[model samples]
Target: MGCNPLHALYLGAFLPRPPPPLPPPGGKQDRARAIEAAVMAHWRAVRDWSPSRRMIRLASPDQEQEEEKKRDLPRNVVVEAVQHLLEWGRQRDQVRGEKHRRNEEGLRPPPSSPQSPSGGSSSCPKAPCSEASQPASNSQPSSGETSEILNQESVNSSPAELDSGVSEHTNISSKEKTPSGLSNPHSQKSEITVNERFLKDYNNIECIADGGFGCVYKAHHLLDSTQYAIKKVKWAIGKEEKVTHEVEALAKLSHENIVRYYTCWTGKDIFPSEDSDSSSGEEKLHKCLFIKLELCKLTLEDWIYSEESTKNYKDDAFEKFQEILKGVAYIHEKHFIHRDLKPANIFISFQNIIKIGDFGLVTTGADDIPVKRTRKKGTKSYMAPEQVGQEYGNKVDIFPLGLIWFEMLHRFKTKSEKSKRWEDVRDGRFPPEFIKAFPTEKSIIKKLLSKEPSKRPPAAAILRMLLVHLFRSSSI
Candidate 1:
């Protein structure tokens, strides 16, 4: 018995470690290889295919010649191509949404229980149980089409699927259930369905600032989970017209320094149902009479003036000032003048990126021709000499920038001379001592704050001078 126990102990010590678990049968690697093979097969299937059936080449002049060569695709290849493209698009959208959400940093939350922008009723085909209702009869076909296009352009799909329960009832099947009983081929349209929960949360946002133009609010988009400083034009005819003009102008213009116009939304009445009798039943509907914008932080003016900023973030203010000039430089390069280039109109993002905002006073035309104006625009202090009917053009824009720069550099000047111009000071009425006190590259400041608008440097020249000065100053 003693010999048997000793032998067992020796056997346990001599065990072969179970052959190292047989490398887990290599299942994961095999699965990975299978997936890669399947992907390569799919790529091979679609690799040589052109993006569209009607591929146009610059060299091909004759339409018939172009049509002669078929793509030589597999049967129903177009459908397959479209389906794959859509799926890829969906994946891309998902990625973008995720990136955007992450960037938002929890400023906005997901919508709770989605409801239609109009109401619970689906009078809008996009809404649930809604019938085919035309937009206001007074609305021109052109306007209606434009609105539809804008709406289509603005709507974004979520990274994740909309609550799965509601997703099935959304697109094709919903169309089939409409009261018309006949499907209009052209009638199926994609629309921006602003969930009520989203709109309420967005609209309830705090007012960041208010001005003659409108009230700006810090609103968030629930879908992408992004925040924006929304400038809401007061719901009035004149203000509304200005909003349209700004939109039209910005649509035609693109520049890095200039604030980007994202999308505009306006409300229109949906006609009451002919079959239903609710004439005086107090039916009410509203579309989002709002514009979506890239959310930005406060303007530089507040930062410069704030005591906390003065102590902690003085250098940041100066850096932001340079960004403002870059923005102005871009405007000038485009041959457009931001007639309003004051600190109030310059917006600073959280990342410290600066952009020129408030296009209400911008003008585009030849240098010789006066910037046509029906009425005076801009704050009093920042208005250039030419803006006050002094034959202003591109140079007029830079004057305000110079004054703003002065304001940022020298906080000694108690109040901005916005109510008047350089001429007002040079003419011995407003006191040149105050104007001369502006701390800057002296030569540039002199030219920028020149009495004659024509004598002042154009925005480009000013920008170059300022850029050089900034570079030199930073090096020192």
Candidate 2:
């Protein structure tokens, strides 16, 4: 007969309890011991709870095999799952550590040099990284200390190495010692030099012109005593990319009719010191872009309207117009459109050569396709009808060319005539007097001022026609 339930309960209470769970496996040896204890306990429980002979006889080989398979399956799956989770955790920690390191590096102050007995920071006198390699945290250098380090490195190393190292650090101290008379009150003159060669090559900077973008200064070269125009653009925070793009476009272009591009310089300067009475301290930095260009005697607008330009120089004027056409045609050939082709932007050298300047409004694309622009650009008086409202092609330049030609020919005696001329061109009317004086020019003007862009001739064709006229006039 089965044991009474009360007796079974009393026996179970007396039986030894399983050992407290082994302290979580410390090492390989501990883990092995814990696993062994678990297996032994399981075997002992099975042994103590003996089954009847009939039960043992009914348990077949197939049933034992199935039990073994079930036991093995969980062990393998659990081991693999644990390993995968451990690996994932390790990778996550590594990624987080890398990000933390970078953040620390960015926040760390520039390494400073040791102070000398004289109360000034000692110079490196050797390589820059001699101390840099040691560690940045160990030394907390002031801006003057860092500047001294760079100056020392520049003296010891090649110019190329100096440039590469210094350009990477935006807060480099300026080396300029002398004060300039033209310094702006809002901006401090920091001696931080970019392309020191440029500074040494050119001197005596005088402001020649100022525009929406920047100021132009007339500078003379020390070597050849040649004059050049240096455009100084104060760097605006978000407009850096635009300035870079303009520089890239100018760099790529190489034509006699296009303004020559010189080297570009970019660097930071301290805003003019606010405290006149106080000694030097850290000041806010301002970035600037300096573009050097060929100097021109005057713009087309200056030449055309000057009091001394009144004498009949029709042949000279036509020749100048021909040069302008050549420049425009060259620009079109290079797959670029000079959207702002007004008199102010057309520069004339002392040699009387016409060159297209101010490529700020230039655009590039295939000649056959019209570039769509919503915002109006170029001078209002010179804008093509399509440019004013619709998508325009390279032919938009032709309309402005017509206006330029009219101005060259009529020599608008008064402001009213200038206004009336604009009205006539906008209305597609050629002044009868102009038509009668130069019939051939009138025909050319009529086609250029066509209201429909497709009706206007390409710059290349206009150049060819102008060349033919030049040949005829010269031969006569």
Tell me the tens digit of each residue's lDDT in model 2 across 138-173: 122344653353333222122222322331222213
Q: Which numbered prediction scores highest in lDDT against the true structure?
A: 2
Candidate 1's displacement at residue 125, Å, is: 37
lDDT (10s digit) by residue, model 1, range 153-240: 1222321122111111222222322122233223432222233433433433555666556555676554455787665554445455
- Candidate 2, residue 467: how far the Cα is off, in Å: 2.9
Give the winner by TM-score: 2
Question: What overall lDDT, based on C-alpha atoms, would model 2 receive against the true structure?
Answer: 0.64
Models 1 onward score TM values of 0.50, 0.54
